[model samples]
Target chain A: MHLSEPYLSRRALLSSVTGGTLLLTLGACISGGQEPSPTGPDPIEPVLAASVYLADRYTAAMAAVPDLADRLTPLRDAHQAHITALTRELGTVDDGILPSGRPPAVAPAGSESTPAATASSGNAAAPEVTASPVPLPAERPAILADLQGLERSGRQQAAALCLAGSRYRAALLGSIAAARASHAEVLT
Target chain B: MTTGDEQLAEALRAEHAAIFGYGAIGAKLDKATAQFALQAEEEHRERRDALLLRLSQRGGTPPAADPVYTLPVAVTDQASALQLAVTIEERVAARWRSVLPQAAGEDRTMALDALIGSAVLATQARRHAGISPATVPFPGAPA
Candidate 1:
């Protein structure tokens, strides 16, 4: 995949030529006040869950296949950083769906599996999401490709959110989208 | 607050420099890699040209590209050429990332698109350079 063409950039470029004006027109219609038009179930929470989901998936893949541990850890840590940065914007994560997905300021790298309640939202317990929303494949190469797929999908989702989110959050969303896009390249 | 046009002009400036940097970079690379380098340079040129039109349409004066830009590294060989490529893409990405927070509509779309393009190219350049990890946690973020 070293010489592979960028999967999303091509589509993004084409859409940007046409979508930019249309997106603003649509935004103008619904944007009665300062809040951006809703694109997902929630503003930033879904992005939060998605990052937690990715971080947990990374932890699972690392534990399930030890050979990839060295390569996967940093990618996992990136998701953790995404969580902290996003939660900072959302204030406190009392959304109920994710609980204390927000770490107590900074959770150590290894704390992804703390599996204990933290004071913020008791949602740190969700870290032990050993059983993910998407099940893992037991095979070796399959799991790597599987994780790569997750990164790619997550990248697309984040990119969409980044486009629709507020200008205040655009930078963070764009960074997360870019990070996930890069993570897929590293998976192999 | 930085205006979107200001950021766009800055990114256009970065794109101008990237096109200039790629010329030196391509000279040091092999035929196959140089072809890749040419494509990268072409993309920057396209972006620079587009941003030029965009800024004019918005009634802003686009900055002129310098006749020559100071190379970040002396590209004596392929390794240094690749290093310069990475450096250019990172600078380009940082410029577009700055646009994201300030621009909206088509401008923001262009910013996001260009930012991702720069990030992807940077990863490819890093991989070609044999840099480990080959990807960044945040593409435009300062090291």
Candidate 2:
């Protein structure tokens, strides 16, 4: 059988060859396998860093209230994904998961749960280093309030950044802003 | 019309559709849910009017709202109404997302505001519908 003689066979063969090469090229491009550029710090770093900080808050909240883990985990996971996506957009590393040294603060008496303030590590370049201040909300209500506030501020910051970004970058930032706004609603 | 004005017009169109959808949704919902729908509808109307005026000032003809919109799902009960509300917000968010690329300065800020509002409303509606997680990782991005 002369397989190449059939029009279907020829098209299929060509498509397979080109498709495989295209997939590999796209994968390489997405994975950022090339040498790093020597440009100044990425403009998106601050937003990514803020996401990392929010993720840390979730971690602290979960630690304080183990019972709320099921609810808080998903929120934390979303922020982690945000950090990953934003950092990847800048072709940077995804080391946004650093742990805080402080212990989780227990909810104060009379309150549903006690949450410590968000602690800034004071690194202007990498704001994600700001730890969660060991703020842990031991109850569902407290957790919701804490997360709602954090998400609100995060949404505002991300939206501000989106205004000045390029199209693709702005789209991503806008999505991040939208996600945070939803987070606030969900927490509420 | 400039690109930004055109994008704003697109967003305005979505708001018009949302206003129509919310009217149907509010009718089928309880007092609280219906109130949410009404507020959302009013918000869309406000934005729509503002955009229309802005387009007019720029000498761009604002696209007319569709006489009718087909809902994605039948909103027969509260659950369905909630779902429809969520869908409307998500659709509006997608439109605002498109506007961001062409917008600048205050226009960009407005688009971001609209996107954020829709996203929050979508989540709120999903929460009312008893959807798990209650939040998506990315809102207004195409799957």
True contacts kept of each: 0.54, 0.86
Per-candidate DockQ versus the true complex? Answer: 0.59, 0.62
TM-score of chain B of 2: 0.95
Candidate 1 collision pairs: A100-A123
lDDT of 1 by residue, B1-143 (tens): 14778888889889989998998998799887887798899899999999999889877789998999999899999999999999999989998988898988888889888888888888888878888777877889777
TM-score of chain A of each: 0.64, 0.57
Model 2 DockQ class: medium
Native interface contacts retained, candidate 1: 0.54
Which digits, one per residue and each the tens of the lDDT, describe model 1 over residues A39-138? Answer: 3223555455556556766777888988887788888888888877776666544532223344522565445322122212232222232222345779
Chain A TM-score, candidate 1? 0.64
What lDDT does each candidate get? 0.70, 0.67
Residue A164, candidate 2: Cα error in Å is 2.9
Q: Per-residue error at B70 for model 2, in Å?
A: 1.7
Residue B110's lDDT in candidate 1:
90
